[model samples]
Target: MITVTIYTHQDDITLDQLKADLDSLQSTVEHQVVTIDIDTDETLRKEMHGSTPLIKVGPYTLRPPFNRQDLEVTLRSAQDRVKYYQDDAEYIKRVERGRRVSGADRFSYWFSKQYMLVLNALVLLFVGLPFLAPVMMKQGLTGPARVIYAVYSPLCHQLSFRSWFLFGEQAYYPRELAGIEGVISYEELTQAETIDLNAARRFVGNEMVGYKVAFCQRDIAIYGGIFLFGVIFALTGRKIPGLKWYLWVLFGLVPIGIDGSSQLPSLAKSFFPSWMIIRESTPLLRSVTGLLFGITTAWFMYPMIEETMLETRKILGQKMEVLKQTQKANR
Candidate 1:
C-alpha cells in the first residue's frame, strides 16, 4: 500500500485542509495519508529539528512547499514504477546476472563509453589547465595555453592582475597585449595617471585583448580543487559517509548559497565572510561536489557497459541451454 506522510509546523497548513484534499482524491488512488504536526510531536520534532514541512515515505522524502499537483503526479509515477519492477523481478534478475562473457553486445555501448571519456577529459582539463600555464609558457607554447584561456573565457573573466601569475612579467598575456597595440604598453598602463575603462582595470585590465577565467584566485581554487578531488575519489572508490543522495543535494547547494548571500549588503558583513570561508574551506563541501560530478560521469558509462555485458551473457547462456535441450531430445 502507498503511504504519504506530511510534516508541518504549528499554525501552518491545517490538518483539516490536508484531509479534505486527500478525501477528494480518495476515489482516484488506493493510498493512505497521514499528517504529523512537527511542533507537537516530540519524536518527529527531535528527528526533523531543522527541517519542517518534510514528507517521509518508504525510501523517499519530499520536502515542502511543493506543488500538490506535482506531488500527486510523482506519487502516481512512483506507484507505477514499483508495480512494474515487482512484476518483472524474476526476468530482471535473470538479465542483471548474465550467464556468459561476450564482447561488445551492442553498438551503443561504444558510443556511451566515448561520451563518458570525453566528459572525464573535460573535467581534468578544467581542473589542471590553470596550473599548467607556467609550464606551457616556459616551453614557448603560449599559443596552446591561450587557446585554453580562450575556451574558459565565458566561464571566467580571466583577470590578469587578480590571477596568480606563474612566470615573470614576460609570461603575462595582458602585458604582451598592451605592447602589440602600440597605443599603450605595460609600464604606461600600470602607471596611468587616471583610472578609466580605456586604461587598465587592476583585475580585468585591457578588455580589448587577451583571455582569462572570469573569476578571481578564490573561485578557481574552489572549482579546480573540486574537479581534482573528483578525479581522486573516482580512482579511490570513496563516498561520503552517512550522507544519502537527498542530503548530499542539500549539502552540495550550500556553497552556492554561502558564496552568493555573502555579497548581499543588508546582512552583517561578519556573517558573510565567516560562512563563505568555512563553506569554501570545508573538505566535506569539496568532496561531495567532486563526487557528484564524478558519479554523473561514471553513471553514463557504467550502465551501458553493464547492459551490454548482461545481454551478451544472456545470448551465450541461451546457446548453452539450447545445446543441452538438443542432447536431451536426441537421447
Candidate 2:
C-alpha cells in the first residue's frame, strides 16, 4: 500500500483542492491518505512551507503545485522504479549508491560540526569593518571610506561629535555644546555656522582633524565588546550556559537603554521645560555604558546559540558517521 500525506496549517488556501486530488488516487493505487498539521510541529513547518502536501508513492515523493497528470505520471514512474530495483541486483546497488549523500552534503555536515569557526568569522567581520573605514580614509581613499560609512550609517548615528577619530589631535570631536572641559570642542576645530548635524555626521575628518571611524564611540565599544566576548567563549569550547533572563535585562539591556533613550528627547532641548535639564552624554560615559551592554548581551545570546549549534553538530556528525560506515560496508 502507498501513503500520500497532506501537510498544512489551519489556513492553507489550497488544502481542500489538494486533499480531493489525493483522495481520487486512493482507489487506483491502494493508498491511504494522512494529513499532518505542521502548526503542531514547528520543526516540520519551517522545513516544509509551500512545499507540503507530500505524496509518497513507492520510492518517490511528490511536492506541491503538482496536478492530477503529474501525480499519475509520478506514481507510474515510482512503481516502475521499485519493480526495476527489485528485479535487478545491479540496479539495486546502483540505486543505493545514488541515494548516498553527495560531497556537498558531507561539506554541510562538516560545517555544522565546526559552527563556532563560522560564528567567530562573522563577529570578526562585523567589528573589523568600522575600524577599516578610518584606515581607508587615512590613506586618502575617500571612495572606500564613503562605502564603509554608508554601510554603517544605518547601524549607527555616525555623528562626528560622538565617533572615534584615528590619526587626529584627539580621539573624538564633541559638540561644543556638550561641555566636556579643556578638550577641543566641535566648535573649536573646523567649527560650525549653525549646528549642521547631517554634515557633522558626514565629516570623516581631513588630515588636520583625523579620520573618523564609521561608528560612534558607544557603538564601537558595543561591537568591540561583543567581538571580545565571542573570542573568549570560543576559546572556552562554548561550554558556558546562557545568562539568566533577568540578569540579561539588568546588565545587558538597562544601562545602555537608560543612557541612549534619555538622550533622545534631549535632541529637542526647546521641547523640554526650562526647569528640566537635558544632559548630553560625554564620550567616556558613552563608551563605558556601551561596553557593559555589549558584553552582557553577547554573554546572554552566544551561549544559547552555541547550545543549539552543538546539538546540530551532534546530529550532523552522527549522520556523517553512519554514511561513512554504510559506504565502507557497501565497498
Candidate 3:
C-alpha cells in the first residue's frame, strides 16, 4: 500500500482538515496515513520545521495552502505510479532493499552518535595501561605487568633508556649522548653498551633503577596528548573548528618528523661518514614533539570524522523514520 505521511505541529488546525480530506477519498484510494508531530520529534523538527502542514504521498510532496483537489490529484498520481511499477522485478527489489533496515544499520546509527565517547575511552585505555604496568610491577604483580609489557612491546621501541620509570630515584634515564647534565645517564647506571639495541629494549630495569613503563616516553606523551584533546573536544561540545591542514602539517608533523629523523642518523652512525653530525634527543624534546603531533593530529582529524558521522546520522535517521512509518502501516 502507498504511505501518506503528514508532518505538522500538534496545535496546527490544518492537520484535522487534511486528515478529513484523506478520509473523504477512502472509497477510491487505499493508503495508510502516518501523522508526525514536528514539535515532539527532533529529527522531524530538524528536517521539516516551519514547513508544516506538509503532506507526502509516495514520492510527491505538498506544502500548505493545498486543497482537497490537490491532495486527490497527488494521491491518484501516486497510486498510478505504484501500479505502473508494482509488477517490475527491479522496482520490487528496490522496495525490498529500502525496507530492510538491518541490525548493522542500527549499529552504524548508534556508533555515529556515540563515536566520540568510544574514541575517548579507547585513548584513555591506550594511554593508561602503560602507566599501570609500572605500578603493577612496583606492587609485585609481575605476571600481569609482564603481560602488559609484552602486549605493548610490538607497538613501541620500549627502550629502558627512553621510557619513564616509576617508584625509583628518577622518572627517566636518557643515553649519555643526550647531554642531560647532573642526572646519571643510562650508560653510567646500567653499564650496558649504547650500541646494543636489543639490550636496551630487553632491559626493564631493577628495583633500584625503577621499572620501565610499557611505552616509551614519547609514546606516552603522544597518546596522553590525544586523550587531553579528546577531553577538551568533549567539554567544548565538539563545536571547535578543525585545525587547518597546513597548520597541522607545520605544527603536528614537522617537529615530530625532524626530532625523530634527526635521531635516526645518530642510531646509524656506522652507515654515515664520520663527518656527519650525530645527536641524541633528550626526553624533553621527544615529549614536546610527540605531544604537539598528537594534539594537532587529533585537532585536524576528529572534526572531519564528526562531520561525516553527522551526515551518516541524518541519513540513517530519515531511513529510520520511514521504517517506522512502514511498520505502522503494516500493523
Specify the highest-lDDT model's number: 3
Q: Provide the lDDT at 185 for model 3.
A: 88
Model 3 off-target regions past 4 Å?
6-30, 35-81, 88-101, 322-331
> lDDT tens string, model 3, 1-331?
7778788887787788889999998777888787766786555687777789998876899998899999999989999998899999999898787677989989999998888899999999998998998899888999999999899999999988788999888988888889999888888887766567888888877799899999998898899889889889878877679999999999999999998888887778889888887988989999999999999989999999888887788768766777797797688
Tens digits of per-residue lDDT, candidate 2, 13-112, equal: 7778876766686666555555666666444566677676665554577787779888877766766666666878887786665447778767766775
Better of 1 and 2 by lDDT: 2
Q: What lDDT is reached at residue 46 by model 1?
A: 65
TM-score, model 2 to reference = 0.67
Deviation in Å, model 2, residue 134 alpha carbon: 2.3
Task: For candidate 2, give the lDDT of residue 88.
Answer: 89
Error of 3 at 183 (Å): 1.5
Kindly report which residue stretches of model 2 are placed more than 4 angstroms away from their true locations once superposed: 1-99
- Which window of 10 residues has the lowest lDDT sum in candidate 3? 35-44
Tell me how candidate 3 scores on lDDT: 0.86
Q: What residue pairs clash in candidate 2, if any at all? A: none
TM-score of each: 0.35, 0.67, 0.82
